[model samples]
Target: MTWSSALKKTARDGLTIERTRLEPLLALRGAAGVAIVVGLLLAFGTPKLAVSSAFGAFAAGVATFQRTWRPRVTLAVVVAVGLGASTFLGYLAAPHHAVFVALLAVWTLLAGMAWAVGPVSGLVATQTIAVMLVTVTLPTSVVGAAHHAALIVFGGLVQALLVVLVPIRRWGRQRDALADALAAEADYARRLRHDPTARFDPQPLMDARDAAELTRRQARYRPGQLAGPRGVAERLRPVLASLADPVLGAPAEGPERDRVRDLLGAAATVLDAVARAIRRGEPVRLPPEAMAVLEVPESGPLLSGPARRSALRLIALLGDVVEASDEPVRTTGPATEQERRDLLRPSVPRLVPVALRAVRREARWSSPIARHAVRVSAVSCAGYLLAAGLPLGHGYWAPMTSVMVMRPDFARTYERGVARFAGTLVGVGVGGVVTAFLHPGVYVSAALAVLCIGLLYLLMRTGYSVTSACIGAYVVFLLGIAGEGWSQTVQARLALTLLGGLLAMAAYAVFPAWETPRLRDRLAGWLRANGEYALAVLAVYARPAERKARRVREALLDSRAARREWEDASARARKEPVRHRGLSRSAERAAEAALATMGRVTMLMEAHLPDRQAAASPGAEEFASALRAALPDAIAAIRERARPDWSGPRRALAEWQRREGDTGVAVRGAELLTDALDELSEGLAAPRRGRAGRGAGRG
Candidate 1:
């Protein structure tokens, strides 16, 4: 064949192959959708069912899809029990209002829990409530309800079978994504220490590190069931463990990536040293030469300006911590100082704000306005259905589906919404066409049920929106089996669904609740909490006895969480106005440093503990109490100064640090503390004339 003809053939062949590969995915998604729709209809629409089996199917599918064993099992059991109890109660009451009350109770309880606990819980709750509501509302005899329940159970079984059998590979994909994220974080952190020019924009590196951490967690939760080279969680365990290392400034070296690797490795050593010091409980001394080695400029040829600055700051901060600990080591030994304070002080100042921001950005869906908008849309959809005189089932399902898919992120919400609308439209149209051809019978319904399952499986593979659309179509088709005709009813249902989507969209966009304002306070509070917790841990560690280590460890963990929360909060605050930013930015960095220092102190504390439990020193105990008492006030001062207009808080913090002699121990502990306080004062006092102008200019 000529070259042109060959090229064309090759292109066509590639396209065909692509389509062929996609066929199974499409089929699976469609089947999953069908299964969910059929289950819902049988459980909620039919007279025989008193509880929703569809929801059970949905919960099971989510579990199978996510590959999380505990949550899936928990959700399934909870939903089953909830639905069964509601059904039994409704049956016992027998009166018209009794079923209504039971349904309301179930819906409220489930919806509330779902709102609080996330999708898995929500799925279970929604199903239980839906089934209860349907059973109570339908004018069905007890035997009929039992039969419906059987059908619902059958539908759930079908859903489970389809989900378990389908080879969608969702968990595998998620795991891969998580692994990629962790690798990126490792790369970024390594670069921060090795690359000088990289300092110009530390945000990217920081962001990558944060993403990596999140992805690591995600991987742990959703590692694919398939056997692999190493489980995602297993691969990530080393990375998470390394995060606690105090000496994170050094990197590791590889063949081509020798510089960063070496730096990370060095950092890891420092962390090891710090951990050792904290465990010892007094002070662990790093050789002067080691301190010098740790002082290498973070900004090198490979780094950017912002990244270099950030790295430099971090290294300098670590140096200060190491230097301060020197005197403490010579004096009482590691456990003489409290463990929590050592871990918390350096990190709480910087990390807390960043973590808070991350959480806010991720969980901003908790806005009241967003909730209201969804409710309004649901109400609007229901109103339209009522006006159009469509069946109660059709109206309720249309709006319920719409609200479930609504999100604060416009793009995501829109995508899912459109897919759902399309799926519903298609499902309704197909159901009408099928009803026209086949007489309503158990055999026909069962066949349709199977078809729905297959479609649901396909939809699940595609996307949530598409899945909703397929499910909608399947639900309408099932209605046909119940003697509803496709004629005008299909058109009416479509119109009502469209209305629901519109209302949901309108609610999402108009007067939406913004999380911007709360960012600052969240960061500040988190930092304060971390600082306090850290001090508490340190106090326990300072007892001069080994028994306090467990308490110190627990307190340190709590402080770590608080620090993370602070960091995330701060990061989010940066996205808003200056006043709303609070102390998040600087606080996050400081917190991280403090935590590293604390880790070192912890190592020292552990090492100093007597082999045979020794009596606690009164001096050490008094010092611990004093430090604990001072930490809250000092942290509060810093936080107060974090305000746009306040410099006084910073001054006060500087004074306190100086008076307490907080500098670990390159000098006298008292002298180091005095120096730190002075430095803080100087730093706080430095004119921000140009900086304020720039910030104001931006405003």
Candidate 2:
């Protein structure tokens, strides 16, 4: 694409906004909470106290809203503690310049590294650092600072209380995610109807699946998600993915193609309704006509190809899910409201174990997250030192910007830097005008600050640039009460933001941790995980069905994680500064083919199991052994970057298929296992291409 086209595309994408149905309501609630707290404080107290109270309100707005009540309350408490502690320390250190600088550096580094913990912890850390920066600049005694911080904490609690009191569609996010995944699948299937060879982008589907799973996990830490439509959604994800590929079954054209297209539309419609029902907390009511499409049989005289077979399976699966969605939410025991709350209630005993595991996970120096922590700490300290030595009035901007932009991956680091700069510029301009012309009284200024905070919450997920712009305006209005005018601070912000971006780029250049170098290992991991999943699935034929299903579930989860890691690594590799950094075109194709084979194997595993007596087949055990051996060999070959012969595994699978005489569970599993092995071998065998393959390689 040309520069102009690219610019246009960026603008279009940036302007495209996204929000949950309840987001606007949440934003309003947050704004109201801040307004109420600040307004009440301003009525009888000094402007400083009122402003400090807004800090709590702003924290609540930024972190506590939009989450379930349990997490919201927990976040509210954390924000309160973080703001109060930072304020107290900032007060004590404010008299000594060197101590203050060190304090800022330490806080920034710790905040930057908090991303190693999780997304929420990182957000709170960043917010805490911002509070410290502003707090230290204020003129207050230690006691006064504590009082102000306490007020801020109170503000966050008030906001949290509001969220709990006024409930909206609690499962809106999860429902929307499942609906989007289903809709994306339907769209992919529709495209296949017109162009049978169309390559599907599984990212959307994959992302939606990940989001659904994340929500489920979060529900374990919070109440209110007890009735979320998780069961049907989880089962429906793979079914949708299976329908995306055309080569899976018989070729449909003409009337068959029309029938497939209709089915796709109907499926999308049913899922859309399911989404609405979930959001509304009601049972799905599919129309009579929609129900008719699901009745189509897998084996009929009119349809005979593999495509027909796959289509029939998809139809049946959709019907089952539709029925499942109609059932009441399942509970483990007597699941009362109190029981649900108890399950998510905080316990030190439970948390200590989880925290220990998290610590162990982050302890590995060679882990990607560890490398990210080190890089972020280094860059943030460097940015601080550079700004300190210069004449910049608010040197905190340098470290703050660096910490915000330096993500674990390359693409985010570059993208966020540009967006942050652009957004800051827009925000500084708007804030400058507001501060200079309006010269508003305390009430108006307070209201303006509240409005900006609300906008910040609403625009956060849209893009970094838009969010930063809103944040810039918010900071200007916020700092105005702290004695800094927008006119004076705007220039420093713009310049420091630019400098911070450059410093982050330089830091990565010097102490690099590029993803391309790690792609091979990630691919190897995926190979082994998929191999284990395949083995576990095949074992179902020999072992008890109940026991093997649990193993299959565990293996599938591991494989999915590995697959996502590999895809993420490949994406980052594409943007690495090094030439020919990513996999070659042929290698990428091989990886994709392997993924397809894995999907097939997963479907086979999830399919209805045959009797364990099927293990009596003479060739079953021999085939299983060969299949098991192929994965380890593939892993070793990928690690050594060498090609391995697949002849033995191929022969074993072919022999098993011939002996079985039909496509039973064992035969299907063996066939997919062979295909996956072949693909991995092909990927490993493909010669590496240099920079010449850069643009045309895997996306």
Candidate 3:
């Protein structure tokens, strides 16, 4: 696709705003949790001591607000441990500037590299850094540090209790995930009903299923329990995949086709209804008409073919799910019970081994996350020194901003820096007016803190700007409760925040990992995967008895995943400031065209039911070999920036087509596929020896 067309497609399907009704409930829960913790501390202890309690509550609220109880427990444990360590580190290093900078740098490096594992691990590590920096100003000896640490743990415990005791929506995240997966399947089926040759992207549905499964595993439900909607959703997944097949979806047009479409349409409606009912914890109530659509005659003019047979099976599956609503929950464990038991049994210590393994895995010099970690550590250390040397009141804010704004990619880092600075400025202005005018007491300040924190949680996913603004307001009210004046705090924070943003931007400038350089490898990977998938499909036609349906399916999935990765890489590369001039636009277009043609070839191969006799057709194996060889040459040509001859593959395809008794569809698919290969080869024949081009920026 051209740049303009790609942008339009992205606007249509890429940027989606998810509207979750439970945001209000989550916000309320987070606020109430903080309020309860603060209220108890004020009732039992002095106002000054309540600061520790507030910190604890805030940590717990942030950690477990959206997670289920089981993950909540683990996350709470980690937060408490990290908070304790942070307090100790701060206390130990605060007495000496040199010692503090050294320790902070080490922590920042480790925390930044933790991002390699995943987003959750990254969050935990970053939060630990934030807590340590924020609490470094507290006057604490060894004994006092231990006391503060205990209070922080107590605060997290209180938050956990609030979540467990006052959940607004039971299993909300899990239910929503499952509901979304089912809903996506229904949508895909609906599309197939209208157009058999429609292109289906499996990533969204797969992602939903993966999320739901993760939630189910983490939940503290009874072992092997698959109750209510969870079980139904799992059973529906494989059925939905089969229904999406072109062969089943596009039957011969007549009364049979009409009946099949009607059944499918009704089934999609029923699935949607079930998804909603699952989300709301309501009873499943299929309309009477929906059931009647499933009662078509087995031998009538509308129901006597393979298509009707498949439709009957689908209807029967739906009926069984509805009729068997009252049975005990059926568990489909990922592994056998014995295996789970064996793995969990006590053995020799493995913690050190696992830790070493992970370290070795992420220690590579070429790894993006590792390079980013180094950048963060260097910038953080520099920001700290700059802040301390200046007249800034709080030296930690600059380092904190530097750490928070920097992400794995250039675009995200710059975007986040802009959002953080703007949000903090607005927050400081609004907070200054409120604190100076109202001069609220401890109770009122705590209430405001709760409200602001609630807003912060509510807006975090929607937009970084709003979330940052809420965070700023929250910090102001929290300072009020801690007896710090807003006017003094706001100015210092603003200066430090700007410094931090600048430091983040400067770090990226000095040590860049631009995506443009990686596009060649990404495209090559995609071509190789598609080649393997096409070869696998063709191999089935070459030797019918050796064809494995499972292998073919796996190959298709791999190809699709590779294609997605390449597309994402291309988009990110486009956002970079420069592109390799050697990689011309024509080459990019040809690469995409080749992949499109490959898809059509795969589809034709999938639709054809090859017999054992067809395997003996002259030059069939030679044709398959030629197509397989062409893909590597194409990929090599792109990488080396040199053209290869395409005549060999084209001639092989033509010879195979002229051979006696080959199916028309197979011959046509080969011809089109070879033509695409010719185009791709021609596009990549030029050598790389030109100045770089300025990338066309993304919207």
Error of 3 at 527 (Å): 2.5
- Kindly list the per-residue Cα lDDT of model 2 for residues 475-550, writing each as its tens digit: 7886776567677789999999999887876676676677766667788888778777766766666554334556
Residues 624-650 of candidate 3 have per-residue lDDT tens digits of: 788677677767866775665567677
Model 1 poorest ten-residue lDDT run: 224-233
Model 3 TM-score, 2 decimals: 0.80
Expressed as tens digits, the lDDT of each residue in 370-468 for candidate 1 is 353344434433443443355433444444555555543334344555665666676777777776676556436645655765556544555564556
How close is every model to the real structure, measured as TM-score? 0.52, 0.83, 0.80
Sliding window of 10 residues with minimal summed lDDT for model 3: 342-351
* Candidate achieving the largest lDDT: 3
Off by over 4 Å in 2: 1-22, 65-70, 96-106, 181-229, 236-269, 296-320, 327-352, 389-392, 543-547, 580-582, 612-615, 662-665, 688-699
> What would the TM-score be for candidate 1 when compared with the true structure?
0.52
Clash pairs (backbone) in predicted model 2:
249-306, 249-307, 250-306, 250-307
RMSD of 1: 14.7
Off by over 4 Å in 1: 1-59, 66-74, 83-106, 132-139, 157-393, 406-419, 422-463, 480-483, 487-489, 502-514, 532-699
Each prediction's whole-model lDDT (CA): 0.43, 0.66, 0.67
Error of 3 at 328 (Å): 7.0
